[model samples]
Target: MARPENVKFGVLGKNIGYSLSPKIHKAVFEVLGIQAEYDLINFSKTDLSKADIDEIKHQYKGFNVTIPFKEKIMPFLDEVTEDAWKIGAVNTVRVETKGLVGYNTDYIGFRVSLERAFDWPIESAIVLGTGGAAKMAVAVLKDLKVRTIFTVTREKGGILGTQTLSYERLEALCPRTDLLINATPIGSVQYKDQMPISEALLKKQKGVFDMVYVPEKTKLLQLAETLNIPRINGFNMLLIQAVAAESIWLERELDVMALVEAIGPKCK
Candidate 1:
């Protein structure tokens, strides 16, 4: 049976005014005949704290973590699952009597997206961003046995593992990259017209995947399409991960792709 009532769910992060997660989750919940509501729980990084996060247990049933908070929100949780701990990022948290429990469903989303893509031998890949989502991308790339993975960071120093570099080196290295994954928020509502990596860089990619689902097609994806490169967006990942989060909260395995087909491109 469904756990007592997990009617309240939200996505927590900074500058999340553009998030489509509320609509996406609402659609899925409607299909499941679940009377539930999801919200965008946006907060400025400076104003949020462990006390504020832990207090969420009394306010909402559970919530999704995004962008800047994916890694930053971990310490505030009562428990972090092994998988999320291993990834060092937590994107989903369930509020219960015991406290807040953290989990990583972003990896689940990427893993499924990769499986659905055409079988292209990915010897190397260039992943954009160094936040929680980017960590998921690196983890999934390593799982695919990708030998060389370069993670792009905005600052001077980036994550310790892997070849962490800036955008300056992308063009020079793109020719060897079989996959270009955007883990950053460059293509969302805030940066709708911004393409982090240029058309010249996308031309060298065998495939491209953007982790942002808004606009359905991003500037980066449009460039990828023009380059005739195989492309995938974050819609599928978003759906699968939402299903996973609900399953965790409701304590049941959801038919992921079925729900995807049910929701369709109507939302886009």
Candidate 2:
């Protein structure tokens, strides 16, 4: 079958009025010479039902899912890619003849950004949450051959492939962690002045990656920088993931970093 004549794409999530997706994707479509429209569709899980999903399938060619809905949107999908299935979340989805197909571009985005941020290989990492974002981060870290991946959460322990630790245990494990990642929303611009780990503990790690991008410089990343540890914010990850999702919807590959560099100023 041929591609849709006029592709209509957007992102699905709550509190997305500040999303840069519309601008980034619109720029991409222009460069690719494709006719498309990208927008933001904000709504919580309660606001959508089977009927609403059916309406969306009729109205949209594809759309990206974001925070608070990556996992909640799974039941409505007809098919999910292996990576998305393994990660237990879906950030990108397409309306297929059968139904909707889901995929997780977060993995690609995080992995590529990780490569660009670090010259040397990572041996171990401490993922700072067990939510959908953490799952994607853990998946990429494992694929990159990070020998040990420890997941931490506030509640019960033991998640992913490693034992989960509380916030207190980080002090003891920081010495052995090569990379520390914040996959939680604790440090988001919405929830400011929050740091997942203490500055002292963050100093022990060789590097840090924070998955919060709204403020561009999250508290976690700021703390990492204060400690002189090489740190990366999720802004690049955000742009790269949007690029990945567009590639999936277009069914073609584009230069990831080239696109990133092209959209550099806007991303910041």
Candidate 3:
């Protein structure tokens, strides 16, 4: 027998055929014993610009946003949490009578995962890409007291108001970078075996964190492993953030460990 949709939830993104979010959330719901449905609301880049957020509010109680849509979905939201507002990205949205409210848990996830993965002091970091995830990464890195933060993007000039640099500059800055984070989709499932930065540059960092978890070990993390640099994948970050979002949607804290045990393996 199939369960009726007592509660609704999902993720919104473009080209998300490989997303494991459904599995992760479903597992969380199961462990928490909540009857809900999680689905993928796929949209093309062209479609995202003209997204009908009203339809979303009518359909879901809460939802997760991803990729190009993370920042693009903001204008459609009625209110954004302080962290989301500061980061200029919203990965989670809760529907209320006041309209849709946006929140960004990527920062919490990134911060928690880093604390578990490394104990050394981080004075500086080089973050790749300038998307919503990158913004969250920068925020968390700054919170960790990383004074010098550098962002690398393909854009020739400024990106999201951060001091941006071209990929060409990465090689030179890598030596001085204590931590390197890949917040782009460059090493995603579609771009398998691709690295955001060069292997030589990657070797210079004391630690590397790649926010793409689909493959579990992105090429960037693989390169870090080869160089003996401490590396952490995005799986823990994804799980932690997803759990945090669920807590917000349900208005209560969830049994995170139970959900992690159930969905952690599926993320890989």
Candidate 4:
């Protein structure tokens, strides 16, 4: 199908007025010579009902989902990819005449982030939090042949694989952990000045990757830098995943990493 003269897109989530999605998406569309408008569809006022979702599907070509809603938006979507179904989350959605189709580009985003950011071997990793983001983060690590573990508020079993530790137990694996992938939003606006791991544990890691981009340099990444541990932020992950989602939304495969370099300054 030929695209329309002008179309709409958005990032859907709570307290997202600070999101760089609109900048990134609009820049991509402008470069591709497509007329489009992207907005921040915040659901912080009231609950996001099925009716609100139905309305959004009709209003825009597609949209991106963020924290707190990545999993919640799944049931409302018409079709979810096998990977997304397995991950139990949806960060990107495309509006089809049939219905909304959901896909999780977060794994691809994080995978590419690791590929570009880290050049060393990752023998083991501890992913913080067991939420949707952590699931895909763990999935990426498992695919890379890294022994992965999970840390949540409490100990639990059979959650992606055997190994769920409480926050206090995180330091025990510090010696063996090559990478610390913080999939939790602990260092975001809501939890500013807070990180899940101890300074000692953070200093022991070979590297760190924090998936909180809003602050750009989150407290976790800040401490990692203070300790002289090489680190990367989620800003690139944010851009890369938007490219992955665009590939789904616009019906074409664009190079995720290559596009990131091109879409660089526009995100500011």
Q: Count the backbone clashes (under 3 Å) in each candidate.
A: 0, 0, 0, 0
- Output the lDDT of residue 172, model 4: 65
CA lDDT of each prediction against the hidden true structure: 0.84, 0.83, 0.83, 0.83
Residue clash pairs of candidate 3: none
Better of 1 and 2 by lDDT: 1
Q: Please, what is the TM-score per model? A: 0.93, 0.91, 0.92, 0.93
The Cα error of candidate 4 at residue 216, in Å, is 1.5
Measured on C-alpha atoms, candidate 3 has an lDDT of: 0.83
On a 0 to 1 TM-score scale, where does candidate 4 land against the true structure? 0.93
TM-score for candidate 2, residues paired by index? 0.91
**What is the C-alpha local distance difference test score of candidate 1?**
0.84
Model 2 Cα lDDT, one tens digit per residue, 1-268: 4466577998988777777889888888877788889888887544557886787788898999887788888999999998799988899998877889999999888988899899877998888888788888888887878888888888784456876788777666665678988888887756888877777777778988987877878878777767788998888888899889888888887887788778768645
